[model samples]
Target: MTVRAGREFLAIPGPTTMPDEVLQAMHRPALDIYSREMVELTETLLAELSKLFATKGQSYIYIANGHGAWEATLSNVLSRGDKVLVLESGRFAIGWGSAATAMGADVEVLKGDWRRAIRPAEVEARLRQDKDHKIKAILAVQVDTASGVFNDIEAIGKVIKECGHPALFMVDTVASLGCMPFEMDKWGIDVAMSGSQKGLMTPPGLGFVAASDRAREVHKTANMRTPYWDWTEREGPEHYRKYAGTAPVHLLFALRQAVNMLLAEGLENAFLRHRLLAEAVRRAVAVWAEGQVLGFNVAEAHERSNTVTTVVMNGNDPVSLHRYCKEKCGVVLGVGIGDLQGQAFRIAHMGHVNAPMILGTLSVIEVALKALDIPHGKGGAEAAIEWLGESVGA
Candidate 1:
């Protein structure tokens, strides 16, 4: 017998739980593709996106996901055989670099482990060594979900400047954008890309890129440019060119509502909410870690991201815990991927999540551990509640 009948909770990163208002906003009739309303919608979204990214640069919307945005950013600024420095904190940035390799850009990875954030000193040393400035661009992710590591983007940017490296500093904010503080211009990010799914509280399919003047200048001679992902083409006079084809009307509507909600909450408040919820989850995990089987994937406490927490299941298969949570308790957690596959599970507390949602997810996890006879510290869920009580106040 299972008590799994309910609106199943999704505690996975990306494609997170959607707010009722956002879903209601999408339940509308389609708009005329050529109408003034459509043009205004595109304009407003671009402006709002730039605001969200904290960049004064021009923002572009694409009919794609995070991976597509990777290509768009690459093709817009670098040429064939352009050396790209990939600072690997986890899987996503390496994946972004691999995409560059497939596109003919020479990729070099500054090797980093999954358990820790990227070291700024290593990045500076690498950049200083590139005397010829052969590296055209630097790729990094503000947060890597697979390893649950949060790279210090601001620190890396400062290092790049200190080394006088001319390579464009591009960042992937897919997992951290709305959930954390990311000052694009202030952080010296030349090009930054994110998806609508994770922190933005929208469904997948829309990718956003904000480009600084420096990146746009490089676009002029970028041989990797193609018509579909071309920044110039997207900036054409026609409204249709904004997306390169028919617009994703419903997704735009969903995004607009989601952005509006975020703006209403204020980005700072949203960040705090994510932090509190993430910490509550962490508190529970800390208690469970005493079992000797459950532990955090990220070794450093400070490096843990506010978006998702990856729990490593030592000497145990996470699949059983994952299945027990979903099938018995109606809570779906994120399964491990990349190198950590089968060794970990993730608890996501980003976007549209509140104290109860996080607390409920933790409670279900504790229940699953108990039901599955997995050894864990008692009162894991109570520990989460105590944290919320102390931190959130009455």
Candidate 2:
């Protein structure tokens, strides 16, 4: 008999598990979109978002997803036929490059192994080859959710500065923003974008972009901007300018609560919490990989992400295993994306997640492995518990 009946656990990389407070915050009547209270709230949220991005620059909120943020960044900073150098460490970088191409930008890619982070040396060499500084922007992601690899945006920014490249540096932190440490100004990021669903502990439908003054100057000269996605238009004194239309009332309420939670925990402490939980997950995975059929998709130890862990499976379809965990064990894991499809699965240890939640997810995965007779090493759960014992002690 199935005893796994209760609140379903979501271990997916994004649209992560939301807290009750965030949900309750959104459960109310729509506020007057132009009222004094709502106006003050909109202002406060925008200002707080700048702090979340670790920038003194302006942040624009869109009634869209990460894709909208990508388009918005491109439209406001790059004109048609402008050359952009995209560094592809995994699927998302290439996807961003494709979006640039769709906007009529000339795209050049520096490819890296999907199993490792992009190398600074490679990025520097590529920039040095651009004698005339033909590249307009360098686009990359802080973490590729697909491969569970973490790229060093700071190191890459240093490489760009050292090479004296004038190209704008754009980083996507959709999967790593609130869960990890990011400094937009210190890292020399001209523009950074993320979504609401991942580390912010809010539901999907909001896109955010934090742009530096240098990026704004580029926007003034950019010829491809639209009436809706224009940053300057969105940053006016009027409250309606924030959305270019009526605001997403409930999302704002939810985001208010979510940001409050992050600030309350302290960004550094939140990051440390994620690190501990992620380490616990890795410990469990390491024990399971002792049988050699299960291993990390990312090859390098240091390159792995603190937000999500991708497990590479041999001789088993991960999709079927994922189904078993969700349907039978009441645990929903992320299906492998892009090229890793069917061969790997991801466990997200981010956003409002704690030790009990992570331990429960791991226990269910172990159960699924045993029921499916997958050849994984033993003591996975025990290892996780022991690590948590020493790390986040009783």
Candidate 3:
């Protein structure tokens, strides 16, 4: 009962719809890995990545996922018994803490509600109590993908400095890198890690780790890391050492194309686009939430994420709605995770998404709600459209 004519919409938070330019950029004959063209590409990729992460310090490319990037960041700077304080706002942050635990580091978690951001005061309090500064690193995620909550990393860095804690400030920017503004050097982030699939608008095979001079110094006497994940060797002599071995040449092409597109559009316009699209999507959700059994998982609108909006269904099956939207309509919505699973669903408004795409998605969701007999307010799509018009006008 499904017809396949139009373009299939994939609205997941990561591995978003690929840009035609990026796809075409990767469509080429395989080049010699040691050739001048390939070396130039590798260098350009590193240079542009530094710009994207806003860190002038050393940045490394890895043929791995965000999780591997996590390991690289940890192993590069942390010793076996190092004590790292982790801030847990959602699943990914907790996952990082788990990695630290497995790596034999003592992890102290500062927990926060899934809906709220990390409180800087709590962080400051913890650091102040540690007068001797047993904590070696402060681990945090800029945007936790599961709960769609963003922490004020810059403010937290300020708090760390105010407390005079010498712990390294490490941030995971997997879901928020190019989609939002991340000033790594400006915020004094010792280490910043991210993946290729999210805001970078590439496929999911690459992860990045950017380190400050202080963090790189820690690597000199760090834990025993595997040959591949060791940043020292990767950052050592020879161009091939950067990737540890043969590079993911095609993925490198995609990354180069993605970074070029980002720089071409300018980061300011990119952030503004994501912000406007997120507001419009929330506007539509608010309209639909009027008298229906619908609500936003995040309580405050301002607290909501520009990356994705988690929608809660009061009396309906989120699975059924998600399935209907996928099967009946040509739209793919992200599933809720962890704490909100099955009770809620998510809509991604991140990279490579536009007004038409969001509008179409809202319309399809409205249709699915109606067909599935779920109670939802009318004119949700209209509200989104209205907001889009107003944003364009402004």
Winning model by lDDT: 1
Model 2 misplacement above 4 A: none
**By TM-score: ranked, best first:** 1, 2, 3
Which is superior by lDDT, 2 or 3?
A: 2
**Better by TM-score, candidate 2 or 1:** 1
Report the Cα lDDT for residue 76, model 3.
Answer: 88
Which whole-number lDDT from 0 to 100 does residue 335 have in model 1?
94
Model 3 lDDT vs. the true structure?
0.88
Give the per-residue lDDT of model 1 (tens digit) for 1-394: 9999979999999899999999999998999999999999999999999999999999999989999999999999999999999999889999999999999999999999999999999999898889999999999999999999999999999999999999999999999999999999999999999999999999999999999999999999999999999999988899999889999999999999999999999999999999998888888999999988899999999999999999999979988899989999899999999999999999999999998899899989998999889998888889889988988865
Question: Residue 118 error for model 3, in Å?
Answer: 0.9
State each model's CA lDDT, in order: 0.94, 0.93, 0.88
Error of 1 at 170 (Å): 0.5
Q: Which regions in candidate 3 have their CA more than 4 angstroms from the true location?
A: 1-4
Candidate 2, position 251, lDDT: 93
Cα displacement (Å) at residue 209, model 1: 0.5
